[model samples]
Target: MDVLIVGGGLVGASLAIALERLDLRVGLLEATPPGALPAVFDERNLSFAEATVNALTALGVMQKLRAPTGAIARIHISRRGDFGRGLLEASRYGRDEFGRVVVARDFGEALEARLADATRLVRHRPMRFLGFAESGDDVRAVRVADADGERVLHARLVVAADGTRSAVRDALGIGVEEHDYEQTLFVTRVRGSRPPDGTAYERLTDHGPTALLPRGDRHYGLIHAVARDQADAVASLDEAAFLARAQETFGWRAGRFLSCGPRSTHPAIRVVARQAIAPRAVLVGNAAQTIHPIGAQGFNLGLRDALTLAELIADARTIDAGADCGSDTLLQRYAARRREDRERTIGFSDGLARLTANDAPLLRPLRSLGLFAVDRVASAQSFLVGGAMGYRGDVPALCREVRA
Candidate 1:
């Protein structure tokens, strides 16, 4: 194999698909088998910008998603301390929708189905990575244990996409800097009497930042960031109490919260690996870095990594017919290309988490003012749109509109 991808989650699977399109031999190893979409409805939702939508569309997976779903036409941001209040409308930018929101299971299922159809991918499940040894300039031998037994697979490059607490990254002796926000996020789906009006809401409150993303039906995906100690109490709260608290902090934008689905909580933290690349290896997705989910940058950033790496491989193949698909030079180039965007995104998300978590009077006004300015300033608005849409640098072919 030219590349061995550790982790068969969204990032790894997406990377396999992207690389296979370039005629690269890729192997995907997963601890668990890919899951099927739930028969009943579930609440997990994803916020995909125009660029991400375009990328997935080019890959031919987006068309399989069930649509007429959630499309964010506007975004409303507000702070607890009345410093700035802002609203961004798609109409102002001559766009029909700022982003599209889809159910998480649907997205996962579609990607898995596509992978099953791709011929260049070798899928291994119920598998675990044992270790790896660098053989030469063009090879790294990896040992993996699966249902049958143990086997050795040699590949030119190893890409880690196993997620935040990646075992592959750890085995590679890659150091990481982790910042625990000491905050917990409560996520659930709630059906409301009123529609979302195609608007997403980000409200900074005393507890933390809460977001209400639109969903199919009359329900909305709710993520409430709160202190760790408060999470249990909030989670245990009755539906009425939870709704009351939600409404109290969120205001009356989406009317009233009626009932909620199963609520889940996750600790909020920012984790960045000390290095993204090693000899004959590279880390992508949460394996490289995991940020607080304040801005929904986690998955989008991972997708960018997958797309960029694929583009580099495609370019290399076009240059030399017999080129090593996972050359160290190519991995180095991919690392360098991704540094700026990764740093900027991590810094922005971490800063936003801290700024919103504070109750400082002075900072409040500044944040509010910044939001107002972003709303009023055309350039700022465009920048925000572009960033949210995942179009930071030279967009890859897959990220662009498919040429007819």
Candidate 2:
């Protein structure tokens, strides 16, 4: 196989689809049981930037989603007791929306739909990637096992999308920078007094940061952060008590909280791989970096990783003579190209998470002033809008709009 993609999730599957246009054979290995999706596809809400929506559309994944998506027409940002607020409205930006929100299962279904038509792609399900061996051609001999037994598959390059605790990443001795934020995220479907108005709310409270993302069926996806010690208490509350607590934290600006769906808890930890490229392997998606949900930047950044690498691979084969897809030069170029975007995104999300996760008395006034600048200062607002739209220094091909 020209490329062996591990973890047939969103990032890996999309990458495979993109590479099929090239003159190469591709193989994908999924660890989950046949007919079952990866564990990441759950009830969680995925807030995609405009840039991500464009990339997904170009890759044909968005056209294939089986579920409804909610457009974020406006975003309301505020602190619990601060009068200053930051508002981003679609109309002000000359677009219909800054982004869209979709459920994880729906996104997974879209990927599965695209994967179904990959007639030339090889698929190995219920398999595990044990390790790999260096080949004479400077490629990789990947060892994978299933119920029938084990086999070595040779590929020009190996892409690891296995996620945060990636087996391939571990085997490669890749170090990760990890942070235990001592906060747990509680997620659930919540309803307000009235139907959602195409608006999302990000409220920073003394407890932690809370967000209400507009969802289909006039409901909102609730992500509430709490101290590690209080997470159990929050999740154990009855529907009435839960709604009351949530409303108290978020206030009545969105309206009275009426009810909530079943709740789930996730311990928040940020993980970023020290390096993304090894011998003949590269990490994408959660395997490359995991950030807090403060700015909803995790998946968008991962998708960028896949798209960037796809372009690099396509260019090397078409533009260079005797091109080696997994050679030192190709991998080096990939690393250097991704460094700036990775660092800036990580720092941006980390700063937001840390700033909103705590209520420092001394910092309250300054935080309010910053939010004011975000709303009142044109330059500050433009900079933030650019970031929210996923516009960076090195733009991806699919995300760029053609000029008339």
Model 1 C-alpha lDDT per residue in residues 1-404, reported as the tens digit of each score: 88899987778878888887777778888887556432212456778877788888888778767644688898888877676677888888777887788777778777877887898788877689988855777788888998789988888889999888888888889999999998988888888879777988888876678899987666788998888878878888998999888888888878888898888777887889999998888899999999988777888888898899888888888999678767778888998899888988888889888887887777766777788887798887887777777777756667777423
Per-model C-alpha RMSD? 2.3, 1.8
Give the local distance difference test score of model 2. 0.85
Q: Candidate 2 residues 1-404, lDDT tens each?
A: 77899998878888888877677778899988868889778888889888889888887888898778888898889988766999988889898888899888889888888888778888889899999765676678988899999888998889999888889899889999999889889898888887778888898876567999998768899999888999888877899998888888888877889888878898889999999999888999889998888878888888888888888988998886457778878888888888888988989988887886667688888889999998889898888788777776576797675221
Clashes (backbone N, CA, C under 3 Å), per candidate, total 1, 0
Worst 10 residues of 2 by lDDT: 395-404
Best by lDDT: 2
lDDT of 1 at 230: 85
| Number of clashes found in candidate 2 | 0
Give per-model TM-scores: 0.95, 0.96
Candidate 1 has what TM-score? 0.95
Provide the lowest-lDDT 10-residue window in model 1: 33-42
